[model samples]
Target: MNKNIDNFVPAEEPSKDQPITVLMIEAVGKCNAICGYCPRGQGLLGPETNTYITMDLLDKALDLASSGSNHAIYLHHRGEPFLHPKLDEIIRRVREKGFYTFLSTNLISATPDKVKKVLTAGINQIEMHYSAGLTRLPHEVLLKRIHEIRKLNWELRNFGCRLEMNFSLFGETREIIMEELSRHTYYDETLYVRWFEPHDWPSLEKIIDRGVDYRDCHWYKHKACAILSNGDIVICCLDQFSHSCRTNIKDIDRIDWESLADRRMCQGCTQHVEMNWLEEDAIDMPLWLTRKQEIDTWTA
Candidate 1:
């Protein structure tokens, strides 16, 4: 029984009538924090990695993506995107191409001047990942940073942009997190609580014990492409974690989508299974509860 899962063939590509709605660009691969649940923080990624995307390559990616119809461009993947010196320029370029721009950060680098620059750059949305479970900052410190960011947003008249806080829920801290969420109210702002995925993290056992499953994930079915900082392209953002799924951005035009669908990695990923389940109304519970249930067994 040669049951090595990695050797499984890819599945057939489904029909894709719509243009890519999301284009995720990895602007940088370096970060200031070492969260317990992140692969980068665990030192799984090498130090020699290209820390930032080059301007020339960014231009090419933007040109290629803009040539088609893209709804939004997310300028992050696995690192502190603010570390990129030309982040403002990147956002401005995306806006010039007539696509909404989004960036997620820990807010450690969100100085008042930098916040002003980001707003002036016309970024359409910003997500602040301020979870105590995922960062070194204490809960109170993170909340203070969030307040400061909200203050900055208010000072800029809300910048006509969307601001969101992404909190990763843990069993031990869930109640406290809920209380914190209740205490904070921002006009027109959104809040999200996400399950912490223990990808290559030391806390895999703890997270798995808390009822997380990684099987039959269908996020690849979504119409989106990820461009890594080094100009490599992957069908899914999680695919970047596995080298087997990566293809050069230049070869994107020649990629065989059907074959890509059949990759063993794609077949085994459960990254966005909850989103897929939600699409089908198969899981009737609230989004958070639906995700909390183990993926091996869940139905509408």
Candidate 2:
């Protein structure tokens, strides 16, 4: 989550003792974009009402994770994360709690004020998610927001939050967009771009399949944890829209930290080939997907 990315070893290198490096808290569960390949595009998100995860709930999750190795929280999953008005405040609190934080947003809804506050809010990293070289807004408008963010060189370094771009080759002709976006630099730091194929992400069935080769499992190698906006704690980012969660944040006592890395559930995700489940996090609709829900049924 944070740029400090600690000890991500090869799958064979780490013993079972590898630390759970990141914790995902979906503070906001709504997105401004409706990318067709995403769960939201397929109409499969959690409840629309009361979608913001309040500070109290967040603290509970943090309290549960207090004893873990590398206490970093990836701010959210599958939504325009900045939709929450108190995003800066949330990041500040997480930092105060002795945890690291990062955000991945579409930046379609970003404004100059929001950008400045978020950059200065003690967040360690921020990433812009662009699919087919565009967010929900026109490329021109998206460029304007990028301009807004890039101009904050001082805030970025002062607060420790640097920027990066994640381009999904899901759209037709994403090359031009990637080339255009990569041309810009942020705070003397190159806007590192991570490219992944949405089609390459394995289906839930394949991801859960025990037969998928262990070598293709870079995604689950470095363990991570996740808590939904509504307070439920799932195994990892792959369960973003799935209800097969271990427990809710309120029920922190039931957490099984050691069992997180034993994620046969995440075996096949490709993590952008490694399926870096850390940066990517998703879902649809106003209601949460049930444990019995089948996302495979809703496809392009």
Candidate 3:
């Protein structure tokens, strides 16, 4: 809100000769709740302890993405962006560099105070995750929970942040389900809904099994990349294990994040060459939000 956070034109499409890079900086290394889909829950990914991206590493991330003509920076990947102590700093810095910035959270921890702090911190768009079954709460309880969360939608609207609720998975009954769910949050006009596709899950097995040649993927063609919480640059968001990671952002010299296509981790990788690679239209949110690390501790 302090700078030009509104009236952003969609970035010009990059040519085949030169592709624009959309960077996803994994702000936090830990999550509160464990869902079945994420590799973090399956014990395949995530750090042994809670870790966060440092300010020094964040500057390096901006420099890497700003090397291109026009780009965006998403302050999330597997963990909640709010988990990072410097989340506001991260979003504010990305906005300062004129990148379309975003944040995603389950909103389980999004209290009024925390919501106001983040919405005023220069975020252009924000997405919240919604999945009823994962919470293990009764239907009525879940409804009440969403009702409380949606109350803060007014604040989000006040700051002009595009707020969308992402359903965890796609299903035949999505139309009817979303319609019924929409009734709870009908108070705000800024709210939009998106059906999260199945493949959006952070599973190394599924990606490896169905993956075709790595060259055909959007990450290879469009230069879409992710820097893990530890500053290691991987091929894409799904590379949570850093299997395809080559260079760390601390020593970032070259912009070619996909320079190591021949890595064994890329064998039979995903063929997803589309906008989902460059910009996540629908960001997936975690099931649980409130953790031991409170938002007040995340000071500048």
Top TM-score prediction, candidate number: 3
Q: Residue 89 deviation, candidate 2, in Å? A: 1.2
The clash numbers for all candidates, in the given order, read 7, 16, 1
RMSD value for candidate 3: 10.7
Worst 10 residues of 3 by lDDT: 284-293
CA displacement after TM-score superposition, residue 170 of candidate 2 (Å): 1.7
- As a whole number from 0 to 100, the lDDT of residue 247 in candidate 3 is 64
Please give each candidate's TM-score.
0.71, 0.71, 0.72
Per-residue lDDT, model 3, residue 282, is 21
All models: lDDT? Answer: 0.58, 0.59, 0.57
lDDT of 1 by residue, 1-300 (tens): 112345455554444664442367788977777765676766666675546998887877886676434456788877878888888888888778776677888877766677777777777667887652246665555666666666766666343555677665534576765666566443223445554434433332121233333233443444446677877665655554534344555555533453244345443443555444323321122343224223312121
Error of 2 at 17 (Å): 6.1
Question: What are the per-residue Cα lDDT tens digits for candidate 3 across 1-300?
Answer: 012223322222334467436468778877654656767655665355256888888888787777653445677776767666667778778777767577777655555566666656656566767562344333344445445545554444342455666776645477676566556533342546677654544545432535455555656566566777777776677666666655676765655634334234444454254345353342222222123113312222
Segments in model 1 whose C-alpha atoms lie over 4 Å from true places: 1-11, 16-22, 67-69, 132-134, 139-141, 157-159, 178-219, 244-246, 250-262, 276-300
* Candidate 2: residue 9 lDDT (0-100): 24
Model 3 clash pairs? Answer: 218-273
